[model samples]
Target: MEPQWVPSAADIAGARVTDFATFVTARTGESFPDYQSLWQWSVDNVAGFWGALWDYFELGERSGAVLVSTEMPGTKWFPAQQLNYVEQVVRQARTDRPAILGVDEDGSVIELSWAELLGGTAAFARALRELGVGRGDRVAGYLPNIPHAVIAFLATASIGAVWSACGQDYSAQAALDRLGQLEPKVLVTADGYRFGGKTHDKTADIAALRAGLPSLAVTVLVSRIGGTLPDVLAWDELLAAPGGQIDIAPVDFEHPLWVLYSSGTTGKPKGIVHGHGGVLLEHLKAVALQSDIGRDDTFFWYTSPSWMMWNFQVAGLLTGATIVTYDGSPSTPTPDALWAIAARTGATVVGTSPGYVLACAKAGVVPRRDHDLSALRMVGITGSSLPPSSSLWLRDNVGEHIPVASISGGTDVVSAFIGGVRTVPVWPGELSAPYLGVALDAWDEKGHPVRGAVGELVITKPMPSMPVRFWDDEDGSRYHDAYFDMYPGVWRHGDWITVNDHGSITVHGRSDSTLNRHGIRMGSADIYQVVEALPEVAEALVLGIELPEGRYWMPLFVVPAAGVELTDEVKARINTAIRAEVSPRHVPDEIITAPGIPHTRTGKKLEVPLKKLFQGAELSRVVAPTAVDDPALLTWYAQHTPPN
Candidate 1:
């Protein structure tokens, strides 16, 4: 498809990325004619580009030489530098500005100013100190997306203690699988949380988590609805404690700052560690330069702390943007609840997921008609690939001129590899461009770069935001095997992707989730795009099941929309659409009616996990039942037989 939205001259000139070009010209006495050229310069001249970003963001006092070795994993990056992630974020806080804003599922609101945030962190840091928590100690949060959670994270980072959090919605076992890996010294949590207008007390679940982690020394509780824990510090008490001030002590550049978990669809979640300096620099570029967020911008992203978007959402503060977080049912009192929050907050850049957009589309919820989204210019969507119709739905229903930027990255990097570029036109259902400083390309199984064809998404170069290390993989063998084992030295991010000549990208799905029909490779997303486009289909999951004697079957399981049965006509329509829209070879061998498609809590279809289940493997070995939204549905996959 030809690009539908192009930046006007004013739009191009006013962009931060354009300012970056001017900044480069002034600093290096070189002129970049366009955004892509500047991006190329950023890739080709990593030292100059990253070093300039460090100076531009004023990250910290530069002591060590930048880019000591240009190697992949062993890059001697700022070996002598010292910084703290919290100090870099909090230093930008203006006492007059609101630093954090939150809304509950019950429509309750919470706001914290920069001064209050500073004071709250100081007090919480004192409490952590009292608990004997110090630099390099682990701190964890099992809380909702509330102001207190943000304050607690800031406090943990303030004390140089590593911070990791799982939102209260996670199942107890899933919580154990992730937080158990860290063995945090201090665990901050809420008594309960509200979702879909109902309160779920987390007391028992919290006890289960406590029982699993033997290293936990202190438990702090924030009563959201209202509850008390014996012998536990209240969140208010921690904030109102008598103690005093906190000056963030600078840690080494490579010191482990925080741990983020990889989606453990296959096995135990790998604790991917990132350092203070690397995250600071990467976030500044991503938030300020990539998304065009600034002091005047209100950045809102709907995410649980379990997802990396929560980390990115809070990092918006590093760019002086007020970070607005929502923790509750996106559609409760009304289907337009999230848009109402965006309107109330005057959000400039609204971050969301594709599933949410599709839900709104299916429900006929129109933001432009029901809400005052005058301040909204950008709607950023991630989590999964967006179909072309849904991309157009934003234009037709939300705002004709608004750019709905599709972003793709994961917990692996904790930052986007492919996303929108304000300087370029955004093609519908396509990413605007590759993220600057990321050498992203599509590659075939033979390790050759391929464009305009779906192939393995590979990172040709190392990124600063790449994990500092996996938590327990001491010899780095697991890390190497996870990314580099397939293609030696290069980072094969296990997603199927295609890059067009215009630099726009279409991410199909996970490479592991790709369906192999005979010898042809197909993305499950391709089947979904064709099947879900039919009015009778609500959602779909497709996987090629390999059987004994090299037998194979591709089954398409779909959740039919209300009043729409999986009749013969619908089946024929699906087959015809697949054969027409995709290809004759891309049609599934079987069509089955599924009551509901199973997904991870984060809105990803459980294709790969289900494939393993149908292949006669034990359910537990395939995926953590707690990680899935519907464990019962997963078991049903193994029980149901496809048509002969």
Candidate 2:
């Protein structure tokens, strides 16, 4: 593939990765002639690279060894350091710049200065303390992507309490399924949220969620859309309280910072816990070095509280860059809503999903021509594979000079393993390089490394940001089984990837059965739980298929009851149940009547095989007839044409 864009001489000279290379050379007397060599050195000498980062970033006194072990699930990094993520963020606060810029769907803007953000965090931290939220306690947020969510998260982290959140778009049952596992002490919520030019009242959902969580001692309401709830504390009152200087509680390197949920493919979502020091160091390396964001940049990513990108966007504050949060649909009144916000906020780096970019291309919305994008320097795409045409369209429409960086990572680490580097050329439909300190490789089924062909994505070495533990997994059984069951000691991320000889990577869609729709990951079990509840539905199967040109097709197959027929009314009822119970995004594109749903002999749904069949793969290549419960149903599913 030819290069779509290349960095200028000034970009290479001014990049933080280049500066870090020079620093490494000065410290260890090792010369790295290029980005690939630097990455190679970083992976080969993991301890030295991490130790140098600790000193280069001036992260407080490092006492213990940088790496304790090399085992995958048991590997430990910085075993003796005590640090806080909020404290690192506080060090970058400046009086001259705004710490946060919040925008709503109606074009209202809210700016929080560094002093105000610090005050809000202090006051909320005091309130949490008064409510008996101590170290290791969980604080859950049922809120939107507003500044209050950030303030509440900071306050929770400031007190050494673990934070977890679900966006308002999630239903009461869905939210409870994830947050109920935490047994949190406090719940922060809002009355309503706006999306797609409509106001969604979450008051009833909040009441149900609060009722289900018997462990909640306090409920704080933000009053975003204005409603009253009995026995709830007001957000305004919490921030209005007189607060002194912020108190950042020092925590050990392995202390849990926050809990993020997986898609719950098998059952209930898994609570993945990341530590304080690990997140601090990893985000500093990711945000500062790979993305080339710094003090003068305004980082904006269209994200909600449910996605990992929200956390990644908040890490911009750790790098002294301004962060912007949007609390509505990316495309409401126009296709260029995000672009307009970028223009208004003077965003230097803008992150979005491939679906949004393809929509812009389809709508004939030229961002650089319609908006004042003079400040824009880069466009980032993630959450799914970026088609080559979409990447080229971004280069043509957004700006020829702006690099289109397509990053691939997941909620497991909360950071990218392969992403962009400002010094490297941008190739369409491919990521520039594997991140420094990440021993990433493509391996065949037999564990041999492969190049220029699709294979399982594996990480050979341990990253600082790998989860400390699963929330309730005391024996570490679930944690070990999740990543190590397939490759033994290697971390096998459930994605197929092709690593070229040039060290660039092209990510195919997921190899697992997890459903990814519009960049938000949902479990097929979630849909089945809702759809199969109807009396007319006997059995159900759902598939989220990724097609060419950045299109997604999700279809629900249902087996009707003995006396019932599959009709439009039943389909409407199924769709309504899924939307009201699970999530609107998981609503299937089509509902079809099936003679029976195929499953394995062990009773697990054959989701991955059926998904590949609909994606145009042959049945012989995707599945074996002897392994299925019914071979006839597989043929039935393969005969149906996929949606355009």
- Top model number, lDDT: 2
lDDT of 1 by residue, 1-644 (tens): 77767888988999998988888889988878888888888888877888889888776568768868666565667888888888877668696669888777766667878778778888888888889999999999998888887878888887788999987766566677788998899899999887777787888888888999899998999987687677688888777754345667778887777788875534566789988878888888898888999898899988778778888889888888888878777777787788988988888899876657877887999999988999999999887777777788888888978888888887778889999878888888889998889888899999999987978999887778888889998998888888888888899988878988888898765556655442233346555656788889999888876554234678888899999989999999999987645445567888889888888999788887787677666888888989989878876787886444
Superposed model 2: Cα runs more than 4 Å off = none
For candidate 2, what is the total of clashing residue pairs? 0
**lDDT (CA) per prediction:** 0.81, 0.92
Residue 289, model 1, lDDT? 89
Q: Give lDDT tens digits, candidate 2, residues 147-207.
A: 9999999999999999999999899998999999999999999999999998999999999
| RMSD (Å) of each candidate, 1 decimal | 10.6, 1.0
Clashing pairs in 1: none
Residue 579 displacement in candidate 2 (angstroms): 1.4
lDDT of 1: 0.81
Candidate 2 displacement at residue 495 in angstroms: 0.4
